[model samples]
Every structure is written in C-alpha cells, then in structure tokens.
Target: MIDAEITFRKLEIFLCYMQEETISRAANQLGISSVSVHRALHSLEEGMRCPLFTHKGRNLVPLPQAHRLAEHATEVLSKMHQGIDETRQIAGIGQGRVRIGTLYSLTLDTVPKLLMGLKLRRSELEVDLTMGSNSDLLHQLEHQKLHAILISVTDSDVDQHQYEVLPLFEDDIFLAAPKLSTLSDRHSVDLRSLKNEHFVSLNEGFATYHGFQEAFKIAGFAPKIVTRVNDIFSMVNLVQAGVGYTLLPGRLIHAYRDSIRILSLSSDYQMRQTIALVYAHNQQLDPNLLALVAEGRMYARRRSEKR
Candidate 1:
C-alpha cells in the first residue's frame, strides 16, 4: 500500500535532486532549504523501500533506480498539471456556459459583438441569451435564472441589495415621427412643440415611457398620449403610420432608419437612459462570471471611446 504522506512535493524534490546531482544545488533551484530537500529525498526513498541516491563526497549522485523513477516522475507531474488546467477550464469560470439576459435595445449591435468576441476567445464555451424588459430580466436575475443581465436603468422600482451593477453606456432619446410630418423638417423640437399632436408611447413598466414622461414634464406640458404599446417595434410602427410621434433611443433610430424619421430633441432636457450589466454579488467571485464582467467592461470602454 502507498503511504498517504508520500506527497507530490517529495516526488518533485526527488526529480530535482536527480537533475542537479547535489542536495544544496537542487534546494537552491527549488528555492527550498537544503535540509527540507534532503528530508523529502529520504522520505521518498523510504516510501519506495529503496536507497535512491549515493553520496559522492559532498555531492549526491542518483542510483539507476532513482534515474528511472525520475523519468516517470516528470511525466506524472506534467499530467497532473495538465489535469488541473483542464478542470479549471471546464468550471465555467474559465471555459463554460454563460446565460445572459438583455434588453431589446442592446440586441441591435453591442450585445451581439460582445458575444461574438467572447466566443472567439473561448470556443469551448456556450452562451445562452434571453431578451426582455428591465423589470422582467431583473426578476429573472434575482431568481438565479440567468448568470448576468444587461438592462437600461430606470427611475422605476429596483432592488439594490441583490445585484452588482456596472453602468455601461447612455443612449439619448430621439423623437421618431412619420416621414412626411412637419416635425421631420425641423432639426430639433421640444416636447412642447408636440403637445397638440398625438403621441405614441411604450406601456407603463418600460424605461422609455418614464423617460418620455420626464421629458414632457421638463417641456412644461403633459403629453397627449394617444397610444400605449408593448415594445419599441410596435411603437415605431405606430409612429410610421402617421398616427403620432414617439420617443426612442438614438440607437433604435439607426436600427429602423428606413421605417421612421428621427429628430433631435431641442430642449436642454434631453432624455437619456443608462445601460448596465448586473449579476448577483455573491457570484462575482466565480471565475467564469468574473471573466465575463471583465470582458463586458472592456467592451463598454471600447464602444464609449468610439463615440
């Protein structure tokens, strides 16, 4: 039976002693005291039930048996280190699946590029994605249904305790109107300018709607909201129909440029929303999660620099 106390360190010292052929030299190479190296060599020899080395005056020379064991020891240590590296890679902290939730606005460009970059760097990893409203996605994140979530920040209810948030980018809100509307010819228009016109808006829980309300208040008029829709696509569709005008992210205008005309906001009260990626505070230490957060921060910085 093998003695449990015969450790890998002993084997390493044994191999070092064989290579250096001197306890003092081997200890120097290993950054260990000579006494400790000598103890390890003797312990390994005892465990193997054989004398592994012969003393040549002050120098130690390896026996035939010791040379054979040293060869095998090198292979064994190499395999052991390889196993450790592969295991770490499989733990998702190095190379494993990351489930992410994002808002629809981000799905336009930045999120896809980030995912593509992650995939290129770690080909073995799998990414699962979900898109929804900030509130819905945050709820899923709280329930541990997702590894991380990217969402637009809002004035609505938020739970500060459960998540670790990193603010990424801010998108200005633009006024999207029908292609032939009078508002389309203007370079910029305040919310008050659209007070008499019909307005399309997102439903109650959306961050865009809240931003619109704030913009309206700043313009000194409560908007005459004629329609409330669920998603940006529907809101944009309503604006395209000549039914009304709506506030949307600048990114969204670029995405659906063919469908509607985007106009800049005139007042100093420009509406904007901050986007961020959030994860559980406890999971921050997870190697895979930490790597993803680092990648996200890098991606955000790069995109911000381009702006």
Candidate 2:
C-alpha cells in the first residue's frame, strides 16, 4: 500500500517546508501560490495517509514524523539526481572522475592505501587526490573543488545537512619523544611532569594541532612550543632528532615506532580522535568515489573488529 502518486513536486514542497518552516514561506521560495503549496502538502499527506505537520495558532509545526520523512525525501531526491547524472554519463556526454581531499597526516598511509584499494578494483577509474589542512579540505568540499574528504571528526565542525559522514577510526593522541628518552621509560607519562618540556607542534588548522592544544589545556599549562611546523611527518622528524617532544595520533606513532617512543597519558588527560569520510549528501556520487567509500567502510569495519 505504498503511495505511487507521490510526485517529485510534492517531495520538493515537503523539503522546502522543512527548510522554510511554513506554508507561506515555502510557497514564496518555490514561486507558487499559497493555495497550490497547501494543496501539494495536503495531497502528500493523503498519499502517505499520515500528518506531517501540526497546527499551532498561525504556524504549522513539523512533527517528528515530518523530520523522519525529510531524511527519506532527501535521499530520494539525491538518488534521482544521481540517476540523471549517471544516465548522462552512460550516454557519453559527461566525464567520470572523482576529486578527493584529505588532511596532511593521512598522506603517510591512509590515503595511499585507499587509493591503492580504489585502483586495484578499477584501473580505468581516474582519481584526483589533494591534501590540505582540515579546514582547507572542508572549504574545498564546500566550493565543489573536491567530491569527498577524510578528516578528524573531533576537529571538524561539518554541517550534517550538507554532507554524508562515515566515521572511520578512533585514534588516541600519544606523547612522542626520542626513542632512548627517560620519558619513554615511564609506565605512563604524567602531564605535570613535563610542564617545562619543549614541544614541537603542527601549525593551526591541523587536527593534530588542535589535539595538541587540547592536551595542553588538560595539563593546565601552556606548553613551551619550540617551533610550529606544517605537517606531522616533519614534527616526527623533529622529535626523532631530539629537537622536542610532540603530540601525535597512534597511527603516526605506529608508523614510526622504531624511531620514536609514544607514551600514554595518565588519568583525566586522555583525548581521542575520530576520523571520518565525508562527501556531499546532495550530489550524484561518482562511481570511483563510490568505490573508495565502500573500501573505506570495509577498512573501518576491519579496523574496528581488530580493536
């Protein structure tokens, strides 16, 4: 008993109502008469056999059911757009390439592994990968320069309405020091013990930089920052040379463990980084990007299962 007559027009009206929050406002935005807007909603309600809104004096407030419907409506519309784009591509009128963005820290392994996974499946797929800071990547995504991004959820403030997010992994920050250091001999490094320690950190806009700032805040003292570098690998190089200790994610430490010792923080000082794959929710997903997403999901699952 599904509603076969639920037209795209009706769904568009529904989404417009969700955005504008009123019949008149929705109507105004759609450039349609108030009566037509009302009729469309009424028809949709009849088709679904459910009320999407509740009247409150002069205002029409969306019910919880309406919010739920909005999610479906968005997916339906997005899929419809994808269908059209795919149709055009199949007709030999459109290009097929996926532009992916990532933060600098992922360059060491995650991005390369993902690209390898993507290329292994489809050698014909064209993949364009760009690396930047977290905010820079998000900005590129917003400007349509990139179709997808991988970033730390703890450091990103992405708008959920505009993007689909897939959480990847839980990474904890570790204090990275020289391999033969006294701090490495500790069972757990106390943050207060390093009040006067020199620190090497990534410049602002990096997720690790924010994590570094958070660790200091928890320690209740400003770290004696010796130098702010642009990338985590460079900071690792600095730490290995005994220039200073730096905070880094477990992944980075795991990669360079032979050269550095990553110490765990004591109680009330541990913070975690949640990495995620984000892409535009409203666009037609490119086939290659779709493959990358699938691989990323599988990678996340395996990583989670191992832990």
Candidate 3:
C-alpha cells in the first residue's frame, strides 16, 4: 500500500518539473541540482506506483497519470499554505490571544465598546483584561505579562524605544466638583485659580497624577491636595461627596456623567492627556491581538466622527 503521508517537498518537486518540462530548468527554478530533482521525481513516482512523465527528446511530456496528480498536487499545496497561515495566525505567531492591560477609566467606556465589536467579529478569540495604574500596566506589558496596554501617556517617564506606542485618543483634564461647591461658579475652572482649594487625585504611581502635577507646575502653582484615591471611580465619588475637587480625564466624565459635573480648564492651565495603545517591540503577532488592534482603530474612528 502506498504511504498516504507523502512529503510535501516531493510533491513540490513534481509540480516544478511538470511546469518547467525539463529537470534542469526545474532544478534551476528550485535552486537545486538537476540530479537532485531527478531523484525526487523518481521517489515521488515510486511512492504513487504510477508514471508521472515521458521524455520527448529535450522536453518532458505529462502522461495521463501525471495530469491527474498535478491537479491534486496544486490543490494540496494551496490547502497546505492556507492551513499553515491559519495555524500561525491562531498561535500568536500570526494571530492568537491578546492579553491586555488598561486603566479603570477606560474600562467603563472605550475598552468595553471595542471588546464588544471584537467579540462580534471573532467569536473564538480570547482576551485577558487586567486593570491597574498606568505605571503598573506599563511594567506588566514590558515584562511580557500582558501583550499590550492602553494607558495615559505622561512626560516624566517616557520610554519610546521599549514600546511601540500608538496614540488612540486625547482628552482634556476636567475638574469634577459638587454642584453646590464654592468653586462651581461656572462650567469651567482654571488650575491656578483653584490653587488654594483642596484637591483629590489618584494615588502615587499613576500617570494621571503625575500629569496633573506637571499641569500645576506649568500653571505656576502647587495644589493643596486633601486626599488621594486609587482609581477614577473613587476620585469621582470623593468629588461627589464634596470631599474635594479632582482632576479627571474627560473620558471618565463622559462615562460617569451623572456622578459629577465636568468643568473645563482655563486656557493658561489646560491639560490634555493622551491615551495610547502600547506593545513591546518584539511582541509576537496573534489573531486576538490583531482583532484588538482592529477594534481599537474602529473605536477611535467612531469617537472622532462623534466629535
């Protein structure tokens, strides 16, 4: 009985010979010697128990058996390439699971919407979502604990070489305060103008806090910080309780619009935070990662259109 598990190389050689009509020419195209090509053709014929070609002077003519085998060979090669491509995509070598880290601010808004779109398109894909401070998330991404991270970019700890940072969105920092607070005179407030007021902000190691500090510096004032919270939700809660006004990303205001009022900053003290999708330079491409990136792009486009 002929072995069903025939090598693809043998089939490739046979196809090359069938196309070129001469062993020397086929060998030249395949970058192999004519003798090697002849041996491969003989081995393939012997395994199939059928003649594949007939020599006609300088050219080789395809026999009836050769014609049938050629058709099957073409199909086999096409399917093999397709199977390999699909496997690579699923294995994170071409496409696979995308482990992602993000901040709590984005989780309630852009990230969920993007994930929903991705799930609709690729039902079999897996996503591992981790939430943390920007510094912690960036560390996880660098150490390969996560495939990529969505974070707020700050100026102090910028490391461009280690990551492929793609800016997804930008939003101004808003002052969230109680409706009856003394500082809530209008819909907008300046950081320098409220320098004497108590402030609530994210805990240490958060990029937003660092950025807020820089904004204070640029405004030529230091805030009287009253309390520090860990996440945007906590900050909003504190602000709502009249504990203190807190600086938060505009996206958070949109997500938790009912909890607090968003006050735009004055021109001299305006601060914009940039949201970025960051991945390691050497990270492997996977189907899940590709799907996430595609979803992120879609989300960005939709947000832009709405603006």
Candidate 4:
C-alpha cells in the first residue's frame, strides 16, 4: 500500500540523486535548486519509510535498498514515456500528424519535397519534423520517440537487420573550398595533395564524419582539422569564411555554390551517401506513415531514373 504523498517527482529525484551521487549535481541535472532536491529526496525517503542513502561528506552513497528501487524506477519512467508517445500518436492520427525525424542537411531540400508530395496524397496529413545528426535520430526512433527517420547510410555501420531501411536517394561527397581557390579551379586534384590543408569537419555522430575518416585514411595522411561543427550549415559557414575546407554532399552543392566551390576528387577519394527512411519493424503503421513511405519510394524511383 502506497500513500498519496508519494509521487513520480519524488521517484525521479531519487533516481537523479542516486545516479549523480551528490545533491548539487542532481539539482543541476534536474534543473532545480539544491534545496528543492534535498526536500524531494528527504520526502521520498520519508514516504518509503527507509533510508536510501548515507551522507559521506559531500557525496551520498546509495544503500542496497536504493539499488533495488532504481531498477523499478527506470522501468516506470520508460513506460511513462512510452505511454505519452502512444497517447500523442492516437491524438495526432485523426488530425493527420506524423512524427518524422530527419538529418539537418535534408531539411534544406529533400524534406520539403517529401512533405509536399505527402500533402498531395493526403491533404490533411501534417508532418512533425525532428532534425538531428544520424545517430541521434536513430536512437529516438528506437525508443519510440519518433515514428520514422531519414538518415544517410553512407557508413557501412547502419544495422540493416535492426531497422527497416527504404533507400531514398544517393549523394556524393566533394571537397568544398572558398570560391576562386586553387583546388576549386583545378580540373581535378588528388586527395593526398590536400593532406596538409586545414579542414573543417562534422563531428563523429554523422555519417559524413566517418566518410571523411575513411577518405583521409585512403589518402595516407591525417588532416589538420581546424575545428568540428555539429551542424552542416555551420561547417559550410566556416568554409565560407576561409577558415578551412570540408567535404559536403552533392545535394547541398547548389545552395553554397556561390560562396564555395566544390572540387572533384580523384576516384579513390569519392564517397557516396545513401539517404534512406528507417524505422523499427515492430512499429505500428499509421495511415500517414504508410502514405509518406509510399511517396518516398516513388520519389526515389524518379530520382534514380533521372540519374
């Protein structure tokens, strides 16, 4: 039997404090004051009528009871998040909302066209777009935080067995440098020739990052990276400012064509990014998701034919 005084917040505070090992760290993680964290933790212990932790100077050491409680707390929080997702999915289905994740780069061109085509098929369909790096989107999809995601399977690391991947389009990576630069003006350049050049790169979570790593390895020299940006837009901006050069996909060439020049690398340096829609096979298919998947397959066929 549990009292009404015990609540989810108390449980959440308990978990946070347990993981953080200090009241201050827990307070920071929860975005609450230390006093509030202390109060919540104390209230939780009082409600359960057990001591979950013992103070060791500034740190709180969890007892065996706390460890047991933590396992149940994690399950409760996960189920709560899943329940919220289910409720939203049901509510949005009637109003035509589909939760779709996408890479930051696709938001420029591919996503818009996909959504427009989807609207043509189902006028009431509304796409709720979530944009992030390739890895982050996949994680959200796995956790049921999103219905589907569009990511580049450029790296062989995309686990096909875990996700139902529908190939969308292919894009090639090219060296991007400031306009009128020597590499840009050259008919073609060996990748190794630019081994010593300062480079701007996307951080490791992106498929492009892995592509760059592979390309550099093939060239037999490590690039002197000027800096790494999480977003492609910022990476392009850095290249535009003459900070350094970078590798970017063909789909984005038209956007930065004026400020930056894309150079054709030797065959050995060529890398392709395959854009795809991925989802857990176990997910429930809604009408909107079905329509969007159909539109993506149609769009891919049209794109391939043109190529």
TM-scores, in order shown? 0.67, 0.69, 0.69, 0.67
Candidate with the larger TM-score of 1 and 3: 3
lDDT of 3 by residue, 198-286 (tens): 88889877877877887788878778888887887888888888788777788776666676667777776677888878776655355
Q: Residues 70-154, candidate 1, lDDT per residue (tens digit)?
A: 8888999999989977875554344468889987778888788778777766777788899777778888887777888888875
Off by over 4 Å in 2: 1-94
**Residue ranges of candidate 3 with Cα displaced over 4 Å:** 1-96, 154-162, 184-187
| Model 2: how far residue 203 lies from native, Å | 0.7
Off by over 4 Å in 1: 1-95, 154-161, 184-186
lDDT of 3: 0.79
Model 1 vs. true fold: TM: 0.67
Whole-model lDDT, model 4: 0.84
User: Could you give me the TM-score of model 3 versus the true structure?
Assistant: 0.69
lDDT per residue as tens, model 2, 171-263: 888888887678656577877789887889889988888878887888899999999987778889999999888888888866898888888
RMSD of each: 7.2, 13.7, 8.6, 18.3
Give the lowest summed-lDDT range of ten residues in model 4: 88-97
Candidate closer to the true structure by lDDT (higher is better), 1 or 2: 2
